[model samples]
Target: MGAATPSAQGPRILGSRGSGSSPATGPEAPGSPLTASPGGRMGLPGAEILVGLVAGIDVNMPCLGFALVAKDLEAARDVLRVCERLGIELSEPFYTRKGLCVTAVVELPWYENPVHFLRRRVEGYLRYMLPDVRRVRRVWGRLVWKRVRLPAAEADVLMPLVERLLREYGMPGLKLPATVAEDLEELVYEWGRRWRRSYDWAFKVATGRIFRAVSRLSRRHVVLVKLEDLRGIKRKEKWVPVIRRWPWTRLLRLTLGCTPPWVGVALVNPRGTSSDCPACGGELKEHSYRELVCESCGRKWHRDAAGAANVAFAKPVEYLRFPASSPMNPKKPGGGEDGGNEETQRTSRLVDKDPQPRAPRDGSRPVAGVEHTRQRGPIEGLTLTRPQTLPPGFPASKG
Candidate 1:
């Protein structure tokens, strides 16, 4: 995290729900055309460029919260202002010293105490198997009781074969019963089926949320994920079962598998992602069950959103570096002994825009990205406008 302070202007509450019109209900519709190509465009010769926004994702049990922050500080802030003015998906965008951070939380319908659900399923299997096992044991015991009634020599011969059969096919430790192997197989199948259903459902929901977020924003180049390793955490014996069953690693795999080849996914450390404020690097105090407030700046934040924004701004601990000239990179490497690429020089640049839309010689004006012919709905009067360009000599600190 960077060392910075909150704006002296105080928290402006960029997208808070209010007593007036909904913050999502803007005068103009927030929809804008995504004009850049997926992955990125080729940069100037020998210049390494990050052609799109960096996406940071915070994966939690209740929801997957994500925030998009541009590599260029100024562009990120501008994007925040634009999205707020347009009211995109009723999302919350917060202004931070790093840049304008836009966040969205996708709710999940996954089972709480998922371990309990699996245990209940196992109990159901036991219920069905108990009667079968008891019946087989009783029948075997009755046969043994009749052995004494038979002629001595005949009983000896018959008892040996029956006992051998029981040893071969039954659970011998408790005077084994028949069909136990088949019963065990059925129990395992049931457990697997139940677990697989829950796992698949969660991944599906997460994939949909990721795609939806990407579609709404402009082009994105990289996704930073907070790596949550729950294995080493201490827990009670009862909780040990729950922690072992956690699907965080599988969810991380889903994030990796579902993204486009051009999108670089990296893992960042999870420590303090939610505890620290996104606006300032101050500790956050619990404000509510699901909210936290910065102790230093007094900024309130949703627990998950704050974590996601932190992931967006935090440095990645693990990432696959692409060759500067690769399609995924779209930049040329400079001739240097260290294989250094000049891409960092271009990191502060925004996605190139087409020359501002001009009116036709027919003497009529047209909105840049707005479609006037579309039927008016909730965003009927909304028009999309680009943010004003900053002066060349504008202080980088203010940006």
Candidate 2:
């Protein structure tokens, strides 16, 4: 742990929510055209590009918008036809100056307490020694090695110099043990990136969100599919004020403008992608560890995969009917004649819950207070839309 993300000093564009909120809804009609979707304003008719809106979060892997390849407008849906490897999974959750920033946890460290302490001590010193907010702000904002964060950068610059200066002072015990030195360095750099991104997510009224979405979409030439916010699904998930304020769809368009002129953005109404079963129209049973057990057919599904599938392949029927006989929705608790409910929970990505620290991705508790890193990598999920032209102003012209 290099430095914990401090909401006050870091960024906080949006807020966070509780669990089991909106649980999940099923997918819409398979291959149906999506017009005026919530995620983004771009209209995806389902034939032009291989668009797979992200629906849920995997305990092990976080996903963002997934991609598939397609040249013309009438491409076929190949579930496996994705970009090199990208999707719309959020980063680790942290409060930003403006709102919530969702990032992924690439690595975890055990010394969270120490890292936080270091961050506070150093930041305090910076604030005091360098009284000017502008200068202190500059140091904190500068990317570490143009890659990592503050503590990581500071550690790299200071550790050796401090050790050298103190070599004759008999303070050898202050040096970080060689065993944890390597891991600590990596952790700091990573935290720097993660912590700063929280601010980036909310900075400039969501300029960072737009930049990230567009950059990723442009690089892959993939269509940016916007899904509804998952907040509206259930009351259990406390409504996040910042989430309501953030214009994710607008960010998608801004990202589109930044993309190569050819890459496109699209939207999909991701209603009921989480609750209804795709294998059969059966009500899905919520499972621990983020899975859905189909009550009608007794099939088990990973929550993220199922939700992504629904995002991509839900039915054409505008209205969804809950099984009247099911115990969870007995008498169709949220169902009606045309759809389940008029005020149905039409929320967005199950990319997942609160801003709090998450358990290890593998679902195992830390044994002896030690957590092992997973060996897996991010998934190359469904989509296809490659950029034909590089955006303008690449490799800034040297005078």
Candidate 3:
């Protein structure tokens, strides 16, 4: 590996040593299409792409961090460092295994549930159709259910009102029933089911946009994602339902479903991708909001990008079950219930042979410059009014 040479600015660019050549011409260089795409006519065969999934800063906000890097571990670190210093996007097109100039054209805010609208209409319809029924109590912003029950005669009279409500709030292209059912409760439940199904469809469409952009980038390489089960994650010594805070599993399923048959999907252990330094396998300490510094190498990295790069090369500790022989199934042939894929497993074995640097050869500590010395910790009580966008080069997400 080469040593980092800093320009007049703070970020270091990988020169001709650690990477075997300058990144501009190197085979694993992310900037070069010849090497970056990997496995096409000009790319090296059997290369894998990395993606780091970071949850959003706020619980109410529907966003996740998707930083990426696809190159030599050292080179990826350098590129990520450069991106931070230059104020460029955190994820490069190369990390996505997509060619340069690929663009995402999908519309955003994939899921828009009409359950709330239906709830509101039901309240009004009850007042107009059955004056005897009064909302005697409100629980957590919803009208008490027993008060809204209707007699069979009232249900029949409300059929026309229910039909009009469905027409008003129903999504376009959805098939409407020939006539409203005699049971108002059944009709309400049916509308809820229809909306839920439509939500799943919209989620697929949003993910499809991301896949189309990735496919346009490159047609050859498989996308390897580092997924961690964060449903039971702990925060500040308190148990929190992280999945309810954000749809972590939903995003994973959407990614698997949208991927084309030609491209492969592999799930790797997310364990230390964000905490370990990709360059030296050293532990990383938080340096700032969403940034990290390697304790051993003393280099700064954007948390998301460094994690994504490490994911590309991280080994899977356990078998991740998915559909067999599908593009989303990363399991090797004949591995059956326990087999692992070749790309990440092979790379981890190769990396083990190299001597991991425990300390910088230069006999200097990581520069405690103004940038590195800042306070490092999580933001508390942060909230956003609107969904945040993914780092440039991918789809605009509002999941």
Candidate 4:
């Protein structure tokens, strides 16, 4: 779902949570009065429970990095409670992995240009992030292909069905309280304030703005926890020792909840795998860049076609041809002029001893009785023939 309005660049607001300054502003403020309470015990119900799909979108350009863990009604509500405590913005329901899915979109703002921002952010999250754009595109393409494979178009029309389901589930027109903006501002300030000792004011402000904007615009409930904050808590508290303790275990039981069994994890980019030839279990090195040549058999195909074929589950047809001979070497024991001479001797041994008539080399019709020329004529008979001629009008003078 979309946010109420586009984020505006303004001075840092210290402790604001919603749109309006009033505490009685957003969706959760009414049910839980402490939602607007300054420092009282604030309690909210847990989120809805359903199968979850955790999708991480790492944008390279503009360096926007977002992670979404989407669950059904129960889990979503619990997540919302957590987000509310932190003063993050919550949006209305939207379609996602399944029909009528409620999502929380977390926006990440990068101060630098898109390219530089993405590179740096991605390097930080490399373990969780996919490498190439093609991998991300492929994941989406697979989803589309699944729909195309469906027998009926209606069976695969996910978006429309989700919209209908959401309407039926009483999820339309859900709005955020005005005070959420203020709380969001406070949370962002705290996040940035912690880093103020090490970072400049500009960095803190810019980062704070990004955190708030992301919390608000997220499709589902978004929790904007700084990476540094998490790391700091882990270092000081030592999570392993605390997890084993009694009261902390019960108090933070929600965090220990196991994910649903049906949740699927899809790897965006598998390492050392060729995107083109997924079927034949062949690699790009099997062929040149432009042509796909098989090393096993002398089969050749266009590189693109080979890639497509690799994806398709098909048996390869073999064509027989002469095998290429290896180059002969004179120095090698079995290769060289000596080997050729041996082969010629062997061939001669295979022939009969009887003399046979040989053909003329000049290509003239052979005279049946005459022998072919074998030697040159003597030098004494090599004189040139003189031309015979008559005087001008000699016949008339004789008459």
Candidate 5:
């Protein structure tokens, strides 16, 4: 009876903060991780859904947004719709002016983890880099006025130690998360001009971190990023949302591509993501398909995909690995429904099981680990690219 009481009260006790020291947690620590990988995704009728959604962020800020493309048209549309809806919900807080004061937690439903990451990011390694560069500039730029660019060399020397300290000096067994990868990628934008090597190193580090993050999740991750501008959007509205102008998907892909061949990394088509309502099969007629209006049900939803389309299903696979007790993932090593191990392995290796390098190189920069430099994929269903070499101490990405 006594033991049961303590056990019963255990949850409450822990919740009360009277326990021993706990790991530091940010605003997103308590939300479900299901919102990040496949669990956060929506399903299309038949085609394989890539980036089923693209959500805009911070309406108050300059219109920087994200896109989800799967390289496949039908699949991309499904992903885009979800992203569009999420973008509106998130932007609402800012629109109502509530987000300015941290009045409510609006991001927990879909992208909780990313929201938390943005909060924790203010104190990352990036903060230290620029100030150091500035201090050096304050003294150096004055000493040599336009004779030669010496700050680059000086920055190289002063920066590496700080970078090393950040990566190595942390407590043993503490692993950085994918959010830090975003921070590292952002560092490139801030410092890339002054220190090119540092930017490269930061990008390399971010890719490695993201590779590990994408790997641990289920193998069916289809990385949907904005690829190309299919057509110019004709907006009739007096004012367009700021995010419509942002290329959120592009930044995500370029950063992850620094390492190459990450599983689930691909460009998803942005058409039809949010044109027709997933709830109702009605054509959306409002704000260039930005806002989805289901005339049949009258339930309106904000659309996010760049364009429109239809879909169909493919065969399922065998030998699937599901969660330990998840209903879908059987504990037993059951055979796949259609093709057996060979076919399953091939598809899984490209996504859920393998690393998808970002879409094929445009022949501008050389892709590392690509044996035969013949580049003709991305459009014709090539998801896995060559893996790049990782620096020492960086974990090798799983195939």
Candidate 6:
């Protein structure tokens, strides 16, 4: 795999928090009627746009966490309406492959702690999605090519030559003529820089406990959903993160900015749930963590894709629980938490316990050894093995 090139680099900004000014005030203020309502800011302007959905995927080494945010009731309804028309059942867990989609996957490196690893993974995912060289080229080419139709042979030749020139000279990659390159490069650079900063700020805000708590406080009516809850829809769930971070709504506004005759919904994994025989809800047996395997029906699914379909059809109310219950919460009132006595909470978070027993360095008999006889260890009979079946739609190469 290629090392991910730094799309754009600059000092990270953690949003308006440090500025002491609320994020609700700036010209591009998040809570503004014109700006998108992130984290459920109140009194959001009616979504004049037909469908606005925000999906977030928390990428993890083992499983991806995903959530969807629809700005208005109409947008959510539209999604449901489409599912109904397509003959997809929302109540049942299933995948829907529809539309241009993006997802995030939280990655846990072998050495890093889960929380830190997840934080970094989220930051990286957001940066990857922002405006970058590759995205610019792809979008630019499409726009330029659409207006001027040339003979197939001539058009192909010109495009390649232009690309080569840009590469050889270390010139900024733009489809326009050399005369316009200077201006376009500056614009591209500024746009990329701003977006990179915005992404960094947004990421910090999203992952922090403070932000999450504040979000809950601000939007009392909002229901937070997690990808794990949608596991029944798809057999595997790796790409749920990608689906969540995809800026579909932003892309819509950017691309179709004031156009009246624009209408489309892109689905990435369409065959996810519909093609499966609904009679066999037995397909559910396949869902373990992120893999969807139905032994009874002999059907398999990529967990993420299946979940995405289910997400498209499922009502927000059905999967409204948190992804992880807080382990820090006190089970007993007198005990502070973590099963420790009240004193433990006042002193420090650590729990005191008897020293762990050490294991014998080498196998030895209880007496003199002819051949080594092993004693029953704490985990003597238990074996740790890799998961037997891969989640559906997981690329074999990923394994």
Best by TM-score: 1
1 versus 3: better lDDT goes to: 1
Candidate 2 lDDT tens digits, 107-127: 121223333534654444433
Per-structure clash totals for the candidates: 5, 62, 6, 39, 36, 41
Per-residue error for 46 in candidate 4, Å, reads 26
- Which sections of candidate 4 miss by over 4 Å? 1-55, 61-71, 95-110, 114-266, 269-399
The worst-scoring run of ten residues by lDDT in candidate 2 lies at: 319-328
lDDT of 4 by residue, 1-399 (tens): 333342231211224334434545442366531232222212111211222323222221112222334445644555556556654444343443332222232232333332232233322432222233224543543332211111221222323433343244333222112242233334434433333332233333333433443333232232211110011332454444222211212211211122111111111221222333322344444556545554443445444333322211111111011111112323334543335556534544455373334567657676776666556666564554544665777553221
- Each model's lDDT comes to 0.51, 0.37, 0.41, 0.31, 0.32, 0.35
Candidate 2 Cα RMSD after full superposition onto the native fold (Å): 26.0
Quality of model 4 by C-alpha lDDT: 0.31
Error of 5 at 203 (Å): 15
List the candidates ranked by TM-score, beginning with the highest.
1, 3, 2, 5, 6, 4
Please write out the lDDT profile of model 5 over residues 1-399, one tens digit for every residue: 122332222112112333333343531134422111122121121212223222111111112222222333443344434434433222211111111100111211121222222223333553554445344543543332211111221233334443454355441122223344345545534443433343334434433433332232213333322222222432444434333433344344453453223222222334454455433456666744345566775755444321211111111111011112111112214323223455455544555633544543554543667643345546575466655776789886686
Question: TM-score per candidate, in order?
Answer: 0.48, 0.29, 0.34, 0.18, 0.24, 0.22
lDDT of 1 at 233: 47
Model 1: C-alpha RMSD to truth? 23.0
Give one digit per residue, the lDDT tens place, for model 1 in 1-399.
332233211111213232222232322123311111121221111111343465677766557766776656654654555555544332556665555567766666664555454445544554455466556664665433211121221232334443544444453442423354444445545655666687669757765666544433332233233344334543555444345445567666765566544455555667889899887789999979788889898988878778888887775544432211222232334422222444432432223343345565447897778544534566655555645786888754431
TM-score of 3: 0.34
Q: Candidate 2: where are CA atoms >4 Å away?
A: 1-62, 65-226, 229-237, 240-260, 314-399
Clashes of 3: 6
Write down the lDDT that model 2 would get.
0.37
* Candidate 6 error regions (>4 Å): 1-179, 203-327, 332-334, 337-344, 347-399
User: What TM-score does candidate 1 reach?
Assistant: 0.48
The collision pairs in model 1 are 28-382, 29-382, 30-86, 48-343, 171-176
lDDT of 1 at 170: 54
Where's the lowest-lDDT run of ten residues in candidate 1? 39-48
